[model samples]
Target: MILVTGGTGLVGAHLLYRLASEDREIRAIYRTHSSLHKVLEVFTYYTTTEKAEHLFKKIEWLEADIIDIPQLFLVFPKITEVYHCAALVSFSPRDYRKLRKVNIEGTANVVNLCIDFKVKKLCFVSSIATLGKPISDKKMITEQLNWNPETNHSDYAITKYGAEMEVWRASQEGIKTLIVNPGIIIGPGFWNKASGQLFTRIHHGLNYHFPKVTGFVGVNDVIDAMLKLMNSDNFNDRYILVSENSSFKDVMKYTANSLEKPEPKKDLQKWMIATGWIFQKIGSIFGFKRSITKSDINGLFATSYYDNSKIKSAINFNFTPIEDVIEETGHLFLKDNAK
Candidate 1:
């Protein structure tokens, strides 16, 4: 039997679909009732509604939070493979505590449970943000670079790095582990969260574009690489799962073209970023969700790139072009929203 945490999330939902399609007996953990609907929603993206419903029925859904150790342990019986995908991604300073609680402490609990249960293999989904900053302007970040403490890292990054440490410790305790540092995952479901927000902003006619370059991968590609790695001989190692290094301007333009929206004509200057953060900070006091923050602003202007050669070499994989991903995802986004 397989146990997958965060089965309702972007990655976890897709993972569940693949596992269940293979007729694997799997238990998926979710924290809320609404998330069950989300898993079904994600499955429909890849298959017909009828087939998706069939695959969805195969999963044994369990309500559990990774941070709650006692609740987590209740679902671990008869589990051999573990996939830890629950995480909190936030750039706001106000979310610092929640970020640590979910990404760091939650992951610690998962690692402890994996060790205690003597799980055969643990696959952890982490972000590239946990990696160190670029050493030079022209060099792409690889698995070899050491994290520099002097750099200005976001609280989210710090917490993910801490979570990676916990996974590494679990590996030391004799668990066969694999970690994947995925780039921005663009997909069909949960358009309100993370990379899906890019599609939403584009559809709503966003008029500002940043000049930063970062790595991006399709959601399916991420899940594909993850499953391949877990089933392969790859163990106790981390792989960077990036399809391409694209600029925000190009990404937004492609997204706009796909959604048939107007592309952003003006570039966001550094001062504009600073002022926007100030206004967002003020909006937070009135209970408005802040979109951009100081750390996000920094990320917006940074030209961080990643080399995905390691994962490619490991699995002999080829990634879908970002343009193709954006076009397909945009169509799906429109379809889902039209209802």
Candidate 2:
């Protein structure tokens, strides 16, 4: 049997569906009141048993927290494999406590469980944010490029790096662990409400324009790569699972073009950043949920890029084109608008 953390998240839910469809016995861990949502609202989490019943049937849900070692150990009796996809994904600083608990403590708990249970394989789903410790070195980052997140600008970077460290430490202790660092994942079921909100905004022309430079990947391709790891006999190591890297302007224009919508007017991002920062400060003072943070605004607008050859060489797989991915998802979001 397989155990999955963050199984109800955007990437996790899609992974769960694929595993169930392949006839694999699976179990997932979740916490309703946990702090993971403090950052991104954990868009895919279900509030009721009835809501969760809407998905695949063969899977089991364990109401456990990643920081709770005793609860984690209780579920490891017959579990042979694990996919640690749970983490606090956010750009806002409001969720520091929850993010640390989930990302740092949660990962440590998984490592301990793996050692105790002698699990066959543990695939950790880390983020690219952890790859750049003291800011990114190259024009793009890959799996081998290791850096510390301590010097990074945001708390999200710090916590994610801490979580990934546990996996790396476990690898040295004979845990047979592998890490997959994915770019922005987009596909059919964007369970993350933030992603869903982005889609909704784009469809309604609320977020009219965007900056240039970003990374993107399709849900199918990400699933394909991860499933390959899940079934590999000796693929016990680290890999950066980034797909085609593109800029925000490029993605935005392509999405608009694909959906038969008018292209947005190009505007100076400096002014927007200044405005966003001002609002962010005000929101914090007023105890309001600031939609975006200054660090996120800076990161998005930064002229950043990454290399994908390491992943291609390791997996010998082809990535879906950015246009195709955008076109496919864009058309679907358009369809949603029609409804």
Which structure among the candidates has the greatest lDDT? 1
Each prediction's TM-score against the native? 0.95, 0.83
lDDT of each: 0.85, 0.68
Candidate 1, residues 23-100, lDDT tens digits: the string is 999998999997799889888888999999999999999889988988998999888999899888767778889989
TM-score of 2: 0.83
Q: lDDT score, residue 178, model 2?
A: 81
Mark the regions of model 1 whose C-alpha exceeds 4 Å error after superposition. 277-294
lDDT (Cα) of model 1: 0.85
lDDT, model 2: 0.68
Q: Which candidate should be chosen as best, given TM-score against the real structure? A: 1
lDDT of 2 by residue, 150-204 (tens): 4446677688778788987888778888887777776644522544444544455
